[model samples]
Structure formats: C-alpha cells, structure tokens
Target: MSEQLPKEHVDILLAAAIAAPSMHNTQPWRFEVEGHVIDVYLDGSRTLPAEDPTGRAMRIAAGAATFNLRCAAENLGYGTWFGLAPYPEEPDLLARVVLEPTGARNDDLLDLAAQIPYRHTDRHPADATPLADDVRVALLQAAYAEGAELTWLGETEVHTLLDLVLDTDLREIHDWHRRTERSHWVGGERTADGIPSSALGPRSTSYPAAVRDMGTRPADRLRDERQFEERPELAILSTYFDDPADQVVAGAALERVLLTATRAGVSASFLNQPLEYDDLRTKVQRLTQRPGNAHMIIRFGRTRTHTGTARRPVADFLPEEQS
Candidate 1:
C-alpha cells in the first residue's frame, strides 16, 4: 500500500487478469484503480442465468482474474493483499486488491504468469493415457498452495461423477431456456467473447461427455459429431467451505492448478453442469467424503487440439478514468 505503482504495471496486470477462463467465456469481471489498489467487481449484465443461476461461477471467474492480478503484480516486484466482498452493501464489488512494491519477488507465482496465456480450456476427448504420477503430485501440490484440495478420482468415483454429468445433459436437453442460454455463448461466430465454433471440439454422439456439448446443439449445423473418450481422467476441486469468499479463493486455486497443468503439458475442461445444481453439488461433496464443498469437476489429458477460447480486450474491462 505504500508504493505508487506505475500505470504500465497496472496495465500488464489487467491484461493477465482478463485471460482467466470463465463459464461459457462470459468474462464477467470489471476493475477500477484508486492509487495502487484495484477493485474487482462482478458484471451483472453478463450473468448466466441458466448456466449459473446463483452467480457462484461468476465470482469464481472473477477470483481467477484476481489471482492472475496477484501473480502478475508479484512478478513485477510487488506484493498484493486482497479481501473478498470488502463492501458487503455493494454486492457486485467482489474483491479488492492492493499492490505494494516488494524488495523480494515471488518467483513461484512469477513462473505461473508465463502460463496464463497458454492455459486454454480443452473440450476434446483427452487421450486415455494416464497422467504421470509425478505430474499428478505436482498438480495436487499446486492446489494445496492455494488453500484448496484436489482429489484425483478412482474408478468408482469417476463412474458416479460421469453419471452426474450425464444427468445434467438430460435436464438441459428438456429445458429450452437453459439450452438457449448455452447456445448464446457457444458454437457461434463470436469474436470478442463466447466460445468459437472451432473451439467447440467434436460432438459426443454416443455416451454423454464429461464436458458439455456446446458444439452439437441442433442450431449449430456446423458442429461435427465424434466420439469422446468413454472414460475421461477427472478430478474434484473443493474448498473448506462454500461462501462468497471461499468461492473466490477456490477460483484462485483452480487457476493455479490450471497453470500447473498447462506447464506440465496437460489440457483441461470443466464438467460444470452437475456442479451448477444444488442437489448435484451436494452429491459431489458426498463423493469427496463431505470434506468440503465441491466447487469444480475438471477433466485432464493430453490433446493436440489447441483451440483456445476468446477473450474481451482489456479496454473493454478497464474502468473509466478517475475525474
């Protein structure tokens, strides 16, 4: 808080922040800077009413951006301090980050900064090859560093999780509103935001994929059908509790894990449909022995498909200049 950060540093931080993945690539975050402090707010206009009714995923997305901000700041010889929901009265204001010059740099987070742009969501079928044991250990450690737990699922848990993911497909298929909301963000010629058709990967015509079928929807005739891996490599990320603050913390951990995976040559996608529902979220918690609230279901493997999602420009996310 004592240091006056340069504008160029803040610009680099915001650039890294917007690169964090969001649900359906909605990129629901905005920022304002006062002195050296940056306030992160949720964009109420970009809500996913159908996919994220409670705005849980929205907060997580913002949290990931906040983490990126912290990482970028540290790499620039600055230390960051933040609090979630600093102004409870203003609920849309999710978190505030203060950047101060630090004589010592955080090399670990600085290393992660390099992976920010390379970590894209991979929706295609991950090859059946198992992750290297050491790599799995590294990923788990990465989550631990962020105050969250990542559990690699066994066969039994994977089967149950797959069932839960498929159940969501059934619910989505019958709900016109839900399908329509999803269609708005996926398999389109969207340039700034939303998943582009090429990033949609192949459609799963047989068994339900752990990943959502953004490409195969009826309106999208351009999406090609293909079989996904019958059994995807999966993991469950959970926080110690479920609340606005914990959700944000989980988002930070999620991004750390993602960057670690990217550095290790692993690609990932989220099976968020099940985690979107209260009932399904509870079940996923139980599958983890009720240790904590399950925030995300992630699938990982090696895929050559580098179809990264779209991101809005930093100018679009930056707050208006102070008067």
Candidate 2:
C-alpha cells in the first residue's frame, strides 16, 4: 500500500475543506486520514436538528468541503478521487478522498482554488447593478459543469420568491424551538465556528429586505440598520433528484457557482429560509418552473463589505493518529 499522505499536504487540503460554508456556520464535518485516503464524516453532535431535520444540509456541506479539497489538491500538484458514502455500513462517512501524485494542473480549477480562501459570504447590501450577460452565463455553466441546473429569476419570479421567504420568516418566528436553536449559533465572539456579530451584516431597515435577517440579539446593539439593495438579482440552483447523492452533487455545484461569482468580483447571500420548509419550498420550486429540487436560492451583486466567518483549525476537526 502507498504510504500515508504527507502531513503538510493533508493540512492544506483539510484547511481548504473546512473553509466551506455550512448551514448556520455549524461546521458539522470531521476528517480522518487512513493511509492515502482521507475520509469526511458528519459531526452529528454539531447537527442543527431544528433547521435540518432531514440531514440534507449536513450532506451538502460535506460535499462542498469535498469539492474544495479536490480543488486544493489539484492546485497543489496532487489528484484526488472522492467516493461519497464509500462504505454501506458507515452512513456518517460522507465522503472519501484519495490523493495521488499528479503534476498536471487545470488553470481554471486552480483559479477557483485560489479564490477559496478569499470568498466571503457577503450579507451586506449589494449594489443594484445587474451582472453582465456573459458573467451570468459563466456562472450558470459553472453549476452545469458540476451536474446541477441554474435558473435566473425574473422580476415576477423574484417577487414570488420574496413572498415565500417572508412566509418562511413568519413560520420560523412561530416555531420558537427552531428559532432558539438557530439563534444559538449567532455568536458574539470571533470563534472558529458560528457567525459572529462582526460578520452579520448591518440590520435591514424597518421594511423587509430581499435578504435573510438572522436576527440580532439585544446585546448586539452595535449592528446598526442599513438599507439593503432593491431589486437584487436572484437565481435558483436545482438538481433533478432530491436524494442524498443528488444533494451532495448539488452542493458541489453550489460551491462551484459561488467560487465563479467570487472570481467575477460578485458577492452573494442565501435567502434559504423558504428552502428549509416543505410547504414554502414547494412554492419556491414553482417559481423556477422547472423539474427539480431547488437546492438553493442565491441573491448576488457587488458589495464593498469583505466580512467573513472563521473556520475551526484543521486540528479541531481531524482525528489524532494513534501511536
């Protein structure tokens, strides 16, 4: 058997993997290296039960990390092969990435890998300027290349989607348990995981904004109100199926789209409140007028804010080797 991967390379790949965004920034992923194969597992103890009852988001987040690891490995002159749920008995094992020597480098993936460290989830108000046609095409193609579909939302469709998002807000507000569960993750300090107050964009003005309001705590008085962009551009990413494997690939596609947008100097935020609920999610799908599960709803444009949440050190998520 080939010797285990070098610690230095493993660290770099793991770092890139952990940088992936998870639902509520939970960072619900763990890594274990066995020989040349590195495995990804869902940290069930960190699961957001109320927000992700079906465990869909956990799988998606894991796939996003897997995508990043692949990109990082390729950039670093190594090739990676990933098998989702490689073992039938180990359901918690989300993926397995095996590293092999490969000096070949794909310039495009390398470019995306470079942006991985710099991509920040911009919740700040975006400029109302629409993206150029070519840029939009590239982003769509990015998702397509990863085996997902991207649909640009029209003005009417955006209005419908916004209404669904509003309903989602109401639904969440009514469910105190879920709300409380999600709020626990809105941290004040700059911890390795969880969205900090600094990264939480300014509060939306009195009126409803086309973005999610993760809600600030009373003690978080420093977060002043700001007007979000009007008529922000929106898109729906979808997959033909809603199974575990489909969700995984959709996540990889979502990351590809995000990285492509970042490379184009575009910023994005998730208006995924509706996607979390079945009733509201059905309405969201209708807006797409397509056949597939709407994996994510994205609002994107330009933003001056470069706020970013921190990821836990790789050591925190990786298993220690036994002597």
Candidate 3:
C-alpha cells in the first residue's frame, strides 16, 4: 500500500502560508483543518488596532494565506477548491480550502513556490539604481495574474504620495486611542507578530513617508541619513471595487509581486499609510490615475540587507489535527 500522507502536511502548508509578508509582519491569522478541509482564522492578538481598528488587515492577511495555500497545494499535485466564510458563526474564519488529487505540476507554480522562503520585507534603502524596463513588466504581470493592477509612480509623482502617507502617520501618532492600541502589540522585545525595532532599521523619529510605522519604536538613532534613498521606486496595487474581497485580491497580488521580486534578487518594503486613512486612500486613487480603491503601495529595488523578519512557528497557529 502507498505510504499515508503525513497529517503534518497541513502544518507544512501553514508554515509556507505565514511566510508571506503582512502589515508589520503581523502574521495576523490562524488555521484549522480536518482531513482536506482547511479553515483560516484571524488571530485577534496580532491585530493592528491602531491603524486597522476594524480588522481590515486581518482579512487582507487571510486573503494572502488563501493564495499561498492554493499555490502550495498545486505544487503538491493537488487541485485547490475554496469557499469564503462558510460559517457565519465563525466570523473570523476567512476561508476554507479543500485539496483534491490532480496529477499536474508546472514550472510557473514551482518558480513562485520556490520563492516562499526567500521573500522578506527589506526596509533599508533600496539601491539607487533604477529598475530595468523588463523587470518592471515582469512585476506588473505578476500583479495581473492575481486580478489586480500595479501602477509605477513616476519621479514627478513621488512627493505627492509621500505627503499623503506622512499626513496619515501624523494623524495616527496624535490619536491617544491609537497610541495605546499600538503599544499593546510590542512589549520590551520583539514577538512573532508586529514589527520589531531591529527590523525597523536605524532610522529614528518617524518611518519613511512611504512606510507604515506600526508604532513599535523609533529607529531614528539607527538610521543612516545619507543611506536613505530620496527617489525610491513606488508602485500601487488596485482593484475595481473597495470591498473586503478586493482587499484580499490586492493582498494576494502583493504577495505574488513580493515573492517574484525575492526570486529575481529584488527586495521590497511597503507603505500602507495611505490606505490606512480614508482621505489618503482617495488621494492615492487620484494620484495613481486609477479608481479610488487603492489597497497598498510597495517600494522595490536592489538593497544590501539580507535578513528575514520573524514569524511565529507554524505549530502555534495550526489546528490540533494538523499539529
């Protein structure tokens, strides 16, 4: 008889899924599976209550997990079938995926799957060298595959986007409620979820205008003033609708671009500040010359940093059956 598929296979899949970047590397999600049915849950403990008070980021994270699970199952020779939030009682359960036998594997899936571990959110200034035309095209194609579009901001447009992000940051920083909520995620040291000071680079005061400052700590003292790149490459991910499902698609696409960049020897960091504030989100939509439902901004280029950020062990988030 054929050897039984280890029940631990689902846990392996969960490990791969959480490796995807999240806002603040929050890793804001959980999973449960029985047989082939896998259920994804949002771990409230990891929620970014300051910026994403209503758990929007958690839904986006779950959406990213859904995409990763699909790719992983295909790599393992299983066709994926999924449904969204089948049980109303379990509101945090974002998705349910079922794996079915399918004897097929392709290079595209393998190429992306190979990138699962290498992808990291590099915050250090990207190399000043501009991206080649072909690299930009490839990255754009990666976004399109997941039903989203990427708009590369021109040098002339960078300042406008920066202003919107900074404005959002100022609003968050001054809000007493937001301040308390952000403090809850970080203790004296780094944990599995939330951005750690070590990962925030040496910058002090505020984060770059294009990045979200999840209120972990001011790395201003550690940042190299000259090393900060003035004209970082900026790209926006957009969908036609501004709904929960659109956020998920944008997130999955965001992960696809991130992993593709990792495989291509490019490093990326994100600035979700514009999307965090409603007015700023509208401004980004106008700036991108697209619909007003922009989900995130990603800055990418070559960077010298090589460290990967922290993540909770897969067993911690996996359901008992798989664990």
Candidate 4:
C-alpha cells in the first residue's frame, strides 16, 4: 500500500483551501486536523454584519473552502467523505472530512487543484466575445456535479438583471443598513474583507449600476474607465431550496464552475446586487426561469486587466473553538 500523506500535506491543503475565493475574499474560515479527519470552522469575525448579517456569506466561504479541500485531497489520491455542520453544539464547526479508500490521483483533479492559486476575481469588463461551445459545456458539467444549474441569461434577461442590479445598488447606497454593512466589511482602509476600491472596476457617477463601487466617496484606488467597454456575459447558479445548506451547496458549485472557467482561460465577476434586495431577487429568479432558488449572478468572458484582491491571513479570521 502507498504511504499516508504527511502532516505538512494537510497544512498545504488547508492553505489552498482558504485560498478559495469567498465573497469579497473574506477568507472566513479555519482548519483543524486530527489524524485523517479535517475539521472546517466558520469564523464569524470576518462576517459582513451589514451585507451578510445572517452569516450566509461565511457559510458560502466555508463551502468554497470545502470545494478546495475536496479537490486537493482527491489530487493526493484520497476520496473525501464529509459531514456538514457536524456538531449540534458547535455551530461554527461547518464541516468534517474523512479520507476514503486510497487510489491514484486523477489528472483532472490535479488540474483543478492547480488552479486554486491563479483564480482571482476579474472585476473589469470582459471582451465582447461569447464563450466557446466546449468551454461552456465543461462549466455546465462542473456546476451539475455540485447539484446546481448554470444557465446563461439571454438578452432580455440580461437587461432585466442589469436593471435590477442598478436599482439594488442605488438602494443599498442610500440605505443605512447597507452603508453600515459595507463599512464594517471594508474596514477603515479597504485593507480586508468586502470588495476593495482597487477591484471596483471603472469609476462612474452614482447611477443604477450593476457593479458595487468600493471606490465611492473619499476614493482610494480605482480601475480605469476603458475597462468597462462592453456588457459582460452573465450566468446564474440556482438550487432547489433557499436554506443555509442549499446556499453552501450553491457556493461550492460556484467555486468549481469559476475554477473550470479559469482553467479554460476565461475571466469572471460576481454581481449579487439583484439578490441583495428580496423583491429584485424574486424578479431575477422568475426572469432567469429558475424553478428553484437563484443564489448569485455571475459574469464571465475574457478580460483586458487583472487586478488582484486582498485576503486576510489565515491567522486573523480563524476561530478558536476547534483549535
């Protein structure tokens, strides 16, 4: 039989796991390894009190980490058996993963695991070209593997989604709760959590806009206007239920699809504006013909600029309950 992976291998995987993109790169999680079992902890310290007061974003972040862990463990030839929200007493303990029977790592697993580092959120506008047929099929397959559906928004749906985004953005900008939430997540200097000014795409006057501008008011760093030249290719991930469990599942699928796109030489951005407002969220679901819960709206295509976002160190946001 092959030798078991060393402790350092687990640590490397944990690092790669946190490297998975969370909403705003929040990195809201920690890890605990005991023998072959790995525990994932949800750290509410990084939770956006205003935007994600219910800790949904944190759950989704943990889901992204879970996806990364699964990919890395599979790359090392271990099938993963994981339990979600394992302990009734410990709400922060999001998941526990146990290694399954040993086998050789598949090449596809390695390819996906290798993409953990290179997949950054490209907020700039994409080139005005549609995705290749083969690439789109691959993305669909990846999304399906995680129990979610990825559907492209047609012209009418896209315009409807764009309008919903703009309306939501405007409302959030004026709403006290949203303003407070943005401030809480962004920190004082755009140093950690939430979208940073550097990744806010092009700067424009307050309008019903699709993208959130972390650069608004006392602006720090902003992207050039030329990057927002064309409308982006938008897609949505939908699940059958609107519960926390389903949200986590949707998030995991979202990461897998994003990684697949990244591997296929595509760039993407997430626009959750429509869903931030309950009414708009419902409108979007109906518009997209989503028979279930529409979790997030994502845009993908080729991009001209690459702007790297910031992430909190693994030490800062990790919870101590499992440590």
Please report the candidate that would top lDDT against the real structure: 1
RMSD over all Cα atoms, model 3: 2.8
Off by over 4 Å in 2: none
lDDT of each: 0.85, 0.84, 0.74, 0.73
Candidate ordering by TM-score (highest first): 2, 1, 3, 4
Rank ordering of all candidates by lDDT, starting from the highest: 1, 2, 3, 4
**Candidate 1: C-alpha lDDT:** 0.85
- Runs off by more than 4 Å, candidate 3: 1-5, 85-90, 186-188, 204-226
- Ranked by TM-score, the better of candidates 1 and 3 is 1
- Model 3 TM-score (2 dp): 0.89
lDDT of 1 by residue, 262-313 (tens): 9899999988778888999999888877579989899999988586877777
Candidate 2 lDDT over 1-323, as tens digits, reads 35887788889988999888888899999998888888889998998878889888888888888899889988878877788777778889878888888777777788899989878788888887889999999999999998999999998888788778777777766798786886789858867888888887877884557778775477665578888877888999889888787888888998989999999999888988788898787778778898889878888899885869988878888766621
Candidate 3 has an lDDT of 0.74
lDDT of model 1, residue 139: 91
Q: Per-residue lDDT for 226 in model 1?
A: 70
- TM-score of decoy 1: 0.94
How far off is residue 113 in model 2, in Å? 0.7
Output the number of the TM-score-best candidate. Answer: 2
